[model samples]
Target chain A: NSKVIQTPRYLVKGQGQKAKMRCIPEKGHPVVFWYQQNKNNEFKFLINFQNQEVLQQIDMTEKRFSAECPSNSPCSLEIQSSEAGDSALYLCASSLPTGRQDTQYFGPGTRLLVL
Target chain B: AQSVTQPDARVTVSEGASLQLRCKYSYSGTPYLFWYVQYPRQGLQLLLKYYSGDPVVQGVNGFEAEFSKSNSSFHLRKASVHWSDSAVYFCALNSNAKLTFGKGTKLSVKS
Candidate 1:
């Protein structure tokens, strides 16, 4: 299994609360991607990082959702002020530089609920 | 803007039966196509991708997809599906390295 580890299997918080989801990519992978899955099982690509730099980010991600990949610390996506609309499963994936034929390894995901 | 479409929202199939999931996309240039599967309470997993090679691409767990340029479609198929194959499948496109994803199709396998 090309395992990608994510922390905090589940989280529940009130409105305006802050939440953080972490991810550890598979060994040797250099690119990381974050996605948000809503109730309809629809996935929205939030952002992705190539190495330590962010290559692309969606408008929703750039607003309220913040992500960082430090050299020493694990990659993480943090929401500053959580809302009911932010209640969704957050997923992380990592892939090689090739972007072609390189399968992305995904974490199980952290389910967040903002009540 | 780039977009993807998954026609079927949900599909139920019997075990050991053939399966097919339809996907269509709209892009300006040569788009990179991908199929991903997500089990219940799990993350999205990469099944296969097509980025300018043979129109037909094979993926893990005996899944295969054929890309049609004329139709702007990439459909996934399996010869004989197992019970464990039940999950939600998503079709995605990468245009100029930026990604656009479809809603998804939920698959249910019954014994």
Candidate 2:
């Protein structure tokens, strides 16, 4: 089983409200990733971090989303203003990043519902 | 750009029957392929991964995948699937530490 943990398994927010979720990566893992899974089962990669440094992020995330993985603290992803279309499941995964092939372990994910 | 394709959106099979889930990927250089299963309301679980060496790789719960470079495919298979195997299967390619995933295929195993 994966040791990754995500807080607030379910969240409900009104439109234009802020929505935030947190994730705790597995111990000894230095890489973390966040993704959004829609109701249609389509996955979109949002952002990733290696330790406290940002690696990659999408254009949507660059605009409305903010994330950070601080040392000794849980990683967090927050949206400036949640929209109805933003209602989806947010998944967090962690990996060791061996510079070759690395398997990522995922958490249960936080399901967001916008009203 | 890299992309993964799962031809089947849904697949149904009887318990104790063989199974095959087709997957095709598009990438310029060598590709790292992976198969992940997601149960209802749960996160994705890695079934298997293929980097190099053997074309056929074994995974947990009697799952296996065969990689075909010429066909640009990594197809998942199982000898005898149980009802518990019913879930969504995703085919993904790893590039630049990012995962490109297919829409996903929902598998239904009837007992």
Among the numbered candidates, top lDDT falls to 2
The residue pairs that clash in candidate 2, if any, are none
Please give, for residues A1-115, the per-residue lDDT of candidate 2 as tens digits: 8999999999999999999999999999999999999998889999999999998988873377899999999999998899899999999999997843898889999999999
Where model 2 places Cα greater than 4 Å from the true spot, the runs are: none
Off by over 4 Å in 1: A60-62, A99-102
Query: Tens digit of lDDT per residue, candidate 1, span B16-97?
Result: 9999999999988888889989888877788989977799999999999999999999999999999999999999887655
The candidate scoring highest on DockQ is: 2
Which is the leading candidate under TM-score? 2
Residue pairs of candidate 1 with colliding backbone atoms = none
Q: lDDT per prediction?
A: 0.88, 0.94
For residue B25, give model 1's deviation from the true position in Å. Answer: 0.9
lDDT of 2 at A74: 98
**lDDT string, candidate 2, B1-111, tens digits:** 999999999999999999999999999988999999999999999999999999999999999999999999999999999999999999999988888899999999999
